[model samples]
Structure formats: structure tokens, C-alpha cells
Target: MATYKKRGYKPKKEKVVEEAIEETFDESQSDVAKAFDGLDEAANKSEQWIEKNSRPLFYGLVAIAGLILAYLLYTKFIAEPTEIEASNELAYPRTFFDQAETAAGVKADSLYTLGLEGGDGKYGFLDIASTFSGTKAGNIANYYAGISYLKMKNYKEAIEYLSKFSSDDELLGPTALGAIGDAFADINQPKDALDYYEKAANKQANDFTTPLFLFKAGQTAMQLNEFSKAESLFTQIKDNYATTQIGRNIDKYINSAKYAQ
Candidate 1:
């Protein structure tokens, strides 16, 4: 009994368990390495894309910044200054006109002429209108010019200046339209007068100017021998605008229109 017994084979369960543990450890290491490699590849692709497209993106950003800067400069420096200048320039003409309203005969006419033509080298309504056609003061100049020309009995000039004037002013807008109709009537263009008179009546729908224009329209329609149209206009004054100055005397015109019809 001198020699040690020879070693025997291990149990099957123990051998299988040890081999599975070794295999699992090896596979886990391989999966981790593959995941790290994928991450490195994605990072490289992102860097390449950024490098390729960076120039255009930078240029686009610069363009947007420049546009914003230019807009700010124009608004502050050019647009605002021009608007202020236009407003200031209107004072000379407006003052001359105010004085002309109270002046009598030759002096009144002279003041109006000065307002239209400018005095002492100062700008007049006509000059302002031509210089600052896009501004509020310039637009008002056209209205003033129109009325001045109307008072001067220059019907063509009245039409020219009035047609150029535009505003949302509640009183002036209707007045300009009615004045145009008056010019047409003075020129013996009854059809044109009637059309503009009707426009004035409907434009702002106020008590004062509406009845006045309606009266003018009725008169123009009668001049055109359109008795039916005249009758309707007078009836409108009687029914809806019976309190105005024109409405007070509207009954006779209504009766006249009815007789003509």
C-alpha cells in the first residue's frame, strides 16, 4: 500500500457548470467591446458631418444678423428722420392757409396763392406734396391744394389735386368727395356730378355730410332728367335724414321729382 490512488474523473454536473461560467464571461467581454466600437464610429460620423456643413451654416447666420442690423439702422436713421422732417415742413403751408381763410378779397386770394406756391422760399402745400408724397403731411397737402384750387375757380386743378388726396378722416374724406361733385356740377358735367354725389352720400354715413350729398345727388339727377332716381334720393332724406339742413327743404324736391316722374 505504498502508492497514492490515481485521480478519478470529476462529476459531470461540476464540469458542465464550470465550462458554462467561462463561456458566459468570454461572451460578455466580446459584447462590451463591440458596443464601444459602435460608439466610436458614430462619434466620427457626427464630427465629419459638422466639418462638412459648418461653412454654409456660419454664412446663413451672418446673413440673418446683417439683415437685422440693416433694418434697425434704416428705421432709426432714415425713416424716422424723414417722417419728422415731413411733419415740420407742413407748418408753413398750414399757417398760410389759416390766415387766408379770414382774409378778404385780393388779400385772401393772394394768401391762397402763396400757400400753393410757397413764400420767402419756404415750402408750400404743393411743394410738400411733391417732396414727401408718402408721408401724412404730404397727403394733407394734397387736400389743402385741392381746396385752394377750387377756391381759385380752377376746376381742372381741383379735380387733379383732389383725386390725389386720400385719407380716413371722417369729415375731410366726405368733404373731398362732395367738393369733387361740386366741381363737376360747376363744369356742367351732371352725370359725373351725380356719380360723385352718390359716392359722398354713402361713403361715411354721417348725419351732416350724408344729407348734404344726398341733396346734391338729387339735384344732379334732376339735371340729368332722371326723375325716378331723384325721387328716391329725396325720399331718403325725408325718411332717414329729416333733421338736417338739407332735409328741411327736401319736401319740395321730393314733390318735384314725383311730378316729373
Candidate 2:
């Protein structure tokens, strides 16, 4: 069995309050902003009008400021408190996983299973994912559960959990895609695996992950007897990533693909 490994699973810092509230900019309020658009005209044309409307403008600015402050207060007081509580609940499984993994052997896999399905008064990642889907902690649980399934060689369940995992992170996003490729490959679905490998390579376009997935994609192409595509993907690593581990060993695969062609 080809086992999948993931980057260290840690609680991703949540910036949801800032990011979520950004969408609340209120396009409907554009009408109010338009009133001040001709401030140049205000400066030159209408001292009397300015004096007459000054009080209302003051009230409008004050009202907008109030709305912003109120939102910040709500996020700080209400949303973040719930976030902290959820994180606290998840800490047990997360810590147990780390300890078991470091111990190595069957214990690690058993702990991963335990973390997915809790017992002994400990909550599992699945519990956190289901009960607190709106929180940042819940999102992290989905990733944990998916990787555990991949390690267990349960491909269908791996796909199910990994498909739901999403992140804009430079590493995790590509990693999730690559893990999906590994799952597909294990099930003799090389074509689907190749697609995900290509997607993972392109997801973040960086040194560490991109070349890794490109290498995996090249291997998958060879499995599908796609010699020409395999040659291209292999040559890409040789040309661009000569210092990477895969790049250093790329010549053997490229030569094989060429010979097959």
C-alpha cells in the first residue's frame, strides 16, 4: 500500500472576523458616499449649502463609525469566545495524535483511528467537524480526518473527507489535492490520479510542492502509458527544478519515456 503523509497538522489561525466582515461592506451604502463625491464642488460653490447640511453629514459619518465599531465588538465578544472554546475541545485529540505519531508503529495508526472516532470521554475529529462546522477548528478537523483515512488505505472514505477539505494556504491546499491523487492511484484509477496531481502542481506553483506533484503526475502518466505526456512532465522538472530531489533523479524516467516513444 502506498501510504500518504501530510504536513504537520496544527490549528490554522483564523482571521474569519476580519475576512467575513469584509463582505459586509454594504454596496447599498454607496448612495450615501456619492453625496460627498463632488467635494470639490462643495469647496467652491456652496458655503451656505455646506452650513445647512453640515449637521446631517456629521450624523451620517457618526452612524457609519458606530456600525463599524459595533461589528468589531460583536466579533471580539461573541464569535471569538466560541472559537476559543471549540479549540480547547479539539486540543485533546490533536495532542494525542502528535504523541502517538511520534511513538511510531501500529500505535500511530491506532491513535489516528481513535482520533477519528473518539472514546473514553474524548471527542474525535469527526465530532468537531460535525458539531462546529462554522468554526476554524471544525475546518481543521476535516483535514485531519481525511489524512487519517488516507493513511488507513481506505480510498473511498479518503476521497469523501479530502474532497471537503479546502484552504487557501500555500501548502495545505496543494497537499490536500496531492493526497487525493494518492487515493485515486491506490484504487487503480491512474487517469483520475494524474488529473489531481496536475491540479496540485498548479495549485500554488512553489518550489517544494509543485515539483513533487509534477513528479507524481509524471509517474502516473507512465502508468497510463502516456509516454509523450510523461516525457514532457519529466523534462519540465529537469529543466526547472534541478536542485530538487526529484529533479536530480529525473533523467531515468525521462529516458524511459523517450525509449517507449
Top of the candidates by lDDT? 1
lDDT of 1 at 160: 90
The root-mean-square deviation over C-alpha atoms between each candidate and the true structure, in angstroms, is 10.0, 27.7
Q: What is the lDDT of residue 22 in candidate 2?
A: 64
- Taking all chains together, the TM-score of candidate 2 against the true structure is 0.70
Give per-residue CA lDDT, model 1, range 34-139, as digits (tens). 9999999999999899899999989999999999999999989987898799889889888878998998788888888889988887899999999988888888
Cα distance off (Å), candidate 2, residue 257: 1.2
Displacement of the residue 261 alpha carbon in candidate 1, Å:
1.1
lDDT of 2 at 193: 98
Candidate 1: pairs in clash: none
**TM-scores for candidates 1 onward, in order:** 0.74, 0.70
